[model samples]
Target: MSLRLAPSSKPSTAGSASVFDTSNSYGLHDTMRFGMRQIASEVTAKHPLENRLAEWENTQDELKMNLARNMYGMHAPIKMAMERSLVIKARGPSMLPRSSNLGLDILVGKDETIDFEDFLNVPELSTDMVDVHTVMEHQLGIRV
Candidate 1:
């Protein structure tokens, strides 16, 4: 997940070093050694980065669930006002962008097309914009 440059070395005191010499076996060996250490520490070792990523993922899921719950609650009053109404459904956030989906039920007889841009302008909802895009693609049946 990262690229690191090899540490620079001091120029040789003798005439052994050349400006055009691109082949530095010692430098290559040192770079490989550094790479091995990096891999051992980051990939093989028990690092906290993975744990932090998991925690962040859980928090995102919780936020998405909260948003969905609030949206469902908001729909309750409108549901009671009329027998049926336009419903906008958004799924909770997921690890994969394509996993999140939205279901919008247009049951009202309205002449104008209601844009959801205004309603979904909230920061919490916009955080998972990829989810929205996925849902819209699913609804519209447009293959990416």
Candidate 2:
């Protein structure tokens, strides 16, 4: 190996890392003669450049994720959870007089409707005045 000195724009001082008067004790060498392409190549990387290595690792992770997604798709429970989240998100005005959340209705698992009590904060119904048709349908699973 030959001793090589790399010139710097900054002046070296006793406090600084570089030494101006002698061959650097550190194994620093000029690699410009080897060409940038030679150093950039992965097959014979002169030194493992950290920035390039990190970029390559990120690209590899992305490729693996895409491949897995394309082959097996999202897991069933995760897909369901995502769909549920989307359903709960606020939607713009659809059919008016329609309450999307249903306030108390949605919590009770009612779909596509707003109950009498839910329409503009009507007072809660008394226990003695339940709808006979809804009660029968709920209990017997058949509409009168």
Candidate 3:
């Protein structure tokens, strides 16, 4: 049988308190925060190792390329091409004859500097040029 108690008629003077005490909840929150921070630190610790490895690999590759370039002279094809393009070609002998008399040239209004454009249009060999084989056979008496 359940026991039943009668209600008290006297008024109580004590202040009412909550069934669940939330006054000390801040300590639990702090503990949880600290645990999460520790986990986060541990998780991120491995990233630096991977990042460092990648950086080291890049540095090594760069060093190897530089070493190869130093050991072998002009090994790069593009560099060679650039150097070749930058080189100034030596000019060939002038086809036109020069006069010994400076006074005659000055009177004729002929400038000392030859115009390269004038000879550019001219053919290297004359129109009446003979074949090499014919000249060799006729002059040297050599049989083909």
Candidate 4:
């Protein structure tokens, strides 16, 4: 396999790591060339199978989260035990509000005339609550 080596921009000292410098052993170039080739191949190639597997894993994770939320409240002692376990393991500082993690594009305006992009991009909070009915009107408005 062909490997290209760019000329060094800096002088090599006894402590420095430079391939072109003659201060180091000549055999170092072969080792560096092999390492560079391995890294190049890893960076450029994408395996489709890995992408598919990751997508499947993400879907399964969402299903598991939904299942936990649905079932935990339905039962009594099981939910209590789960809460206790979670409490014991939770040693980190308190998390930030959910609004901090939300994306800008997720917000919906109360009417079509309102600019949703400008509403969402506001740095400060506008209101505590939202009306879904006002945001989404009856489907009868459209003939189709």
Least well predicted 10-residue stretch by lDDT in candidate 3:
13-22
When 1 and 3 are scored with TM-score, the better candidate is 3
- Segments of candidate 4 deviating more than 4 angstroms: 1-43, 67-144
lDDT score for residue 38 of model 1: 31
lDDT score of residue 124 within candidate 1: 42
Clashing pairs in 2: none
Tens-digit per-residue lDDT, 26-70, candidate 2: 644323423222222324323335444535534443454455456
In terms of TM-score, how similar is model 3 to the real structure? Answer: 0.19
TM-score of each: 0.18, 0.20, 0.19, 0.19
Ranked by lDDT, the better of candidates 1 and 4 is: 1
Better of 3 and 4 by lDDT: 4
Residue runs of model 3 more than 4 Å from their true location after superposition: 1-48, 76-144
Model 1: per-residue Cα lDDT over 1-144, one tens digit each: 112122113322232322223234654424332322233332344445554554553444345445545668756544533433223344444433342233222333232455564366755445454566787678789999
Could you tell me how far off, in angstroms, the CA of residue 105 lies in candidate 1 after the best superposition?
20
Q: What C-alpha lDDT do the candidate models reach, one value each?
A: 0.42, 0.42, 0.40, 0.40
Encode model 4's per-residue lDDT on 5-108: one tens digit a residue.
22223322333334454233644445543333234433544465554554553444345445555766546435544654664454432232234322222221
lDDT of 3 by residue, 18-50 (tens): 223212464332433232223343243344345
User: Residue pairs in steric clash, candidate 3?
Assistant: none
Evaluated against the true structure, the overall lDDT of model 4 is 0.40
